[model samples]
Target chain A: MRKSTIIVLALFAALFLAGISAGEPERVLDQAIRICLSCIGIG
Target chain B: MMERVRRLVQVVFTFLTNGYWAFPFSRNIYQGPLKAICSPGLNCYSCPASTTYCPIGAIQQLMAGLRMSLEMGQLYLGWYVVGSIGVLGGLFGRMVCGWLCPFGMIQELLHRIPGRKFDAIPGLLRYLKFAVLALMVVALPLFAVDEFGAGDPWFCKYLCPAGTLEAGIPMILLQPDLRHTLGWLYVNKIFFLVLFVVWSVFANRPFCRTTCPLGAFYGLFSRVKMVRLSLDEERCTECRACHQVCPMGVRFNENPVDTNCITCLRCQKACPYGAIHLEAGGVRLGARQSRPAQAQSS
Candidate 1:
């Protein structure tokens, strides 16, 4: 039980870290979405 | 004669590379009809640097760039793209998966390499693609994020064997500098290509059969749509030859619906009892259909 819990936690942590580390280009997408939404009043 | 002309024109304008010298067939004139083929699948937006736009990639670029001005008036539309996908699917289902998809063409070319052959994904796991289609492709992007998240390139990013083959490898190859700048995206693309190609040796397009978001989209009208596969149960002799030939695991003897079938014409030829037919509305005939010759349709 303890080993499985650790593995799952590690997997999720890795996913989160990977997203963060994907750097600016990946996040630039988020900014673009926000800008587009704002243009239409939702941003 | 007109239909043949349409198809010939479609081929000439849509093809990326050709040995022909007849005035560069893949130009703007091919745009209208070929858009049906191009829009429904995740074909590359940048290739031939297209005269039009790929809604999936365009939507993504919009989302990534934050451009959502969907009002009563606009240039192109999500609903139009959705309708095209549905119309094509209802009319042909996986036929599009087999014959017209740019990505499927690439996978078929790879399958023809030296020694590897084809196989089917097992029935139990085929459900995984639906999950990806529903959750990752639609729900996560269209609903879960922002007031409306941008469209997800679910197939391109996660399940697309073709994207890796076409975009990932070529992009990396062309940019000698980008190869030195190797990152996770490049690695993931390679990983996806290797896994999908390896699976193809055992199962004929496990990705298409199971997890292709585009296949899932077309499957909505697979059986009862304007165009579909016809099963003549009266003629069936319980011969599993159709089953043996089917890469998608549908049974003609059981009189299955056509939506999931790709209309590849293999079963039309495979059924010794003549039980299978590709039909649009009431029309029926099946020889020289191309998808079976290529791995995507069968």
Candidate 2:
């Protein structure tokens, strides 16, 4: 793999870990568990 | 053989990612532990059968709540979505589009319906996806807020035919109560859904090439992705065979790492001279296999 690819992957992996540590996954789950009425084009 | 494998993989992933089968009885979306993770493809989280979140939808939600999150001191509200997307991009670039996207598979299947096909996509129009990614998915969600300080998922609301097809249509059909809730926006979304569906029949992956923001995001990592297409320049005779076979209009012999390439490996299969090959981390995949030398001397 190229050095750039490794760097990009590592950087993103760190960000992912940070986001998880910050409880973003739970936040995502909270939003996803509900039926997104707007996504269905409902008012 | 590779095409069959690709199709099988597509089918498997499609079913696996959207496997919440109780929707038929419950008429409700999945509310489970798996909802924490986003699907690698563009499957809508609102789809009753969907087991995971849609990355684009999740990102828009976070972006829409950016101001609110900042005030609440939640700094990494959107980081997971962005990071996951970047990690996917860095690993395989648009390979996810060719091999994993249910919508891309749908478009390909539609294109194969034995109709009058047109492959001549406008060169400049290809960049529209990037614009959609920037404005609809990111900018609008961040900047356009209401009195409650939350913004709408502009791409999901006004665009994203995938959501309309996978979530809107199915949810409304299952739950009759949603029928009265439908209005102009519903019709508007259906129009987009129909437009893309019809366009897919006439062209190859028109949505992926022209307007899919997720595909656009992954395409950004085309040059630096770990798994990529490698072209043997010495073996290539500039016959344009790869160009003719490329569904995304990528001229592989000329620009091996073009952002448009989904790395579907159709070019690799089409190169009778064995000029194109798939590579992972600089090592050629399936190196043990030998390609037919039909056009080697030509």
Candidate 3:
């Protein structure tokens, strides 16, 4: 169930991020980039 | 069973308000509870997947050494926001953190994980949250800054397990590339999460009991909130069922909604006498039950 919940959360996140990226507010785009970068090995 | 209803209300409300979990919104949207009647718990920052405002973050924003304060007899006057959020929290106690809080739902879910068990934190460690409250929420923000004495969301930055677990983990997981340079912040957050999870196995809700500045903010109001708890001494049989069932360990066999009480309504269900009923916002929800509800010491 925990695994299932994590998977559901992951899907929700991916879908939401895709929607936001599609809409891509110019003001927050740079910030989102920072978030993605932070996700990776980058600082 | 009545427990299912409780779960339903908790899940539905948590989902609607914490859209921040599933959606990305900006902080500029709507001002928090400085506008609406305070819901009973700590929510995340306004910008997260939340459909509503985060009262604690908003209130903290208005505090001295924050952005700027316009004081009216110790009332935060700016945007009339501070008074509004504080009043609401005072009215609700951290019940917002307990019931309506999206983060609270997350923690509750974590605790409910079948294999999970709460580990006890020593009595000495219990004070950690209070130190966090005094230092991160108040002292550091008030006195420490880069020449600006500017507050930098000390709670969100340092103490908020909810933010770290929810917004931080979700975003980081979605953008896996950020995992590369996971720093002390990530480490610290994971540490707290592990500690919180282990602690939940035995320590009740250590985070809610200790480090949540939002919970701290709401607790201030639990005693005096307009929608207060009324105990029928006639109905209470000193069965201690309520105390035994309370996740917060509040001894509410006397009065309900005590300082530690999150108003989870577990006590209301625990009473064998059909004794407990919740009254709030000009409405009542009764969990009519027979027998003393078994307290699951999870």
Candidate 4:
């Protein structure tokens, strides 16, 4: 594989691992539970 | 023939993701676990039938939380959102824009309406999406906070026509209570949506080309994405037929993986010599053509 391709793969892997460790799924669940009025431009 | 197939795919996807059938008007926003996963395209989170969250909205929320994280002395980012976008982009690039985005389908259908068509889009305008990503989605949310450490989702609040068309208008129509709360921002967003609708009739994908931050994010992965367009040089005659047919004005003969390309496969169909095809992880996924030795020798 090309060096640049390898670097991109490595970067993606590292970020994915960091995201998994950060409790990203739970955080997303918490946020998704409510509607953000501001996001709809109401607030 | 291929165009018909593309339209069919778009229609099917649109129906599948639309939540109106479930009568979201009477219920609260879906709080399902599926909402944790990010949809591949730019569907609105507030869309009642939306099975997953919009990645752009998710990212903005994460950015808004940055102020709180700073005060708490701990880093809190929407890792799932980031990871989903990264993984999806790395795998498919902007194919999501072509094949999956509900808004993209709307724009495409709207563009089909008979009107004066525009061909040239200024090169500078293409860079506007990246600027939006940097300033509206990232910068404003991170810096433009209030006394309570809560920040505005600038892009979603001020700019996103998807949120306006898909979530804003529908919600207001469904709930009479929301109609009373409408303000200048709502009017401004409706005006923006109207302008985009008119613009799409004249120009091809004005939003995808110029303003969509999700497209900008996915575009960053175009060069390295797992699913990619490959050109067989031997069969290519450099006729520029593909370029002529490309809705996004991509010069496919020169750069098959141009960031502007949404991978609608229009170029592949336009290639008379059958020089272009899609590949995933080095395995060809579609029709493969070999240049006849006689033709090559001639």
Q: Pick the candidate with the highest lDDT.
A: 2
lDDT string, candidate 1, B1-298, tens digits: 5335434443544453221123134321122223222244555443322323343443444333233434423223233344445445545566766666655554555555667554655666766767776676555555444545345444445545554554455444444454555666556656777887776665565667777767766666554455556776656667588888776777756756633576666777786655667665576654533333223322
Per-residue lDDT for B279 in model 1?
A: 64
Q: Cα deviation of B174 in candidate 1 (Å)?
A: 2.9
lDDT tens readout by residue for model 4, B1-298 = 8678777877777766664466454555677787776778888788766667888888888888877866886556766677778877877789888888889989988889987899678999999999999999999998898998878889989989998888887777767788788999888888888988888999889999999999999999888888888888878888798989888889998987799888888888877777898888777886576665554765
User: Which TM-score value belongs to model 4?
Assistant: 0.91
Q: Is the docking of candidate 1 incorrect, acceptable, medium or high quality?
A: incorrect
TM-score of chain B for predicted candidate 2:
0.96
What fraction of the correct interface contacts does each predicted structure contain? Answer: 0.00, 0.84, 0.03, 0.47
How would you encode candidate 2's per-residue C-alpha lDDT over B1-298 as one tens digit per residue? Answer: 9999999999999988899999999889999999988788999999999998999999998999888988888884688888898899999999999999999999999999996989879999999999999998899999999987889899999888999999999999999998998899999999999999999999899999999999999999988999999988868888899999999999898899888899888998888778888889989888633544654555
Candidate 4: clashing pairs of residues = B19-B49
lDDT of 3 by residue, B135-169 (tens): 77666666665555445556665555665655566
Candidate 2 lDDT, A1-43, residue by residue in tens: 7899999999999989988988999999999999888887886
Model 4 chain A worst lDDT window (10 residues): A1-10
So what's the TM-score on candidate 3?
0.66
Model 4 misplaced stretches (Cα beyond 4 Å): A1-10, B290-298
Candidate 4 CAPRI level: medium
lDDT of each: 0.50, 0.90, 0.53, 0.81
Error of 1 at B291 (Å): 26
The CA-based lDDT of model 3 is what? 0.53
Which runs of model 1 end up more than 4 angstroms from their true locations? A1-43, B1-37, B47-77, B112-118, B143-155, B176-181, B286-298
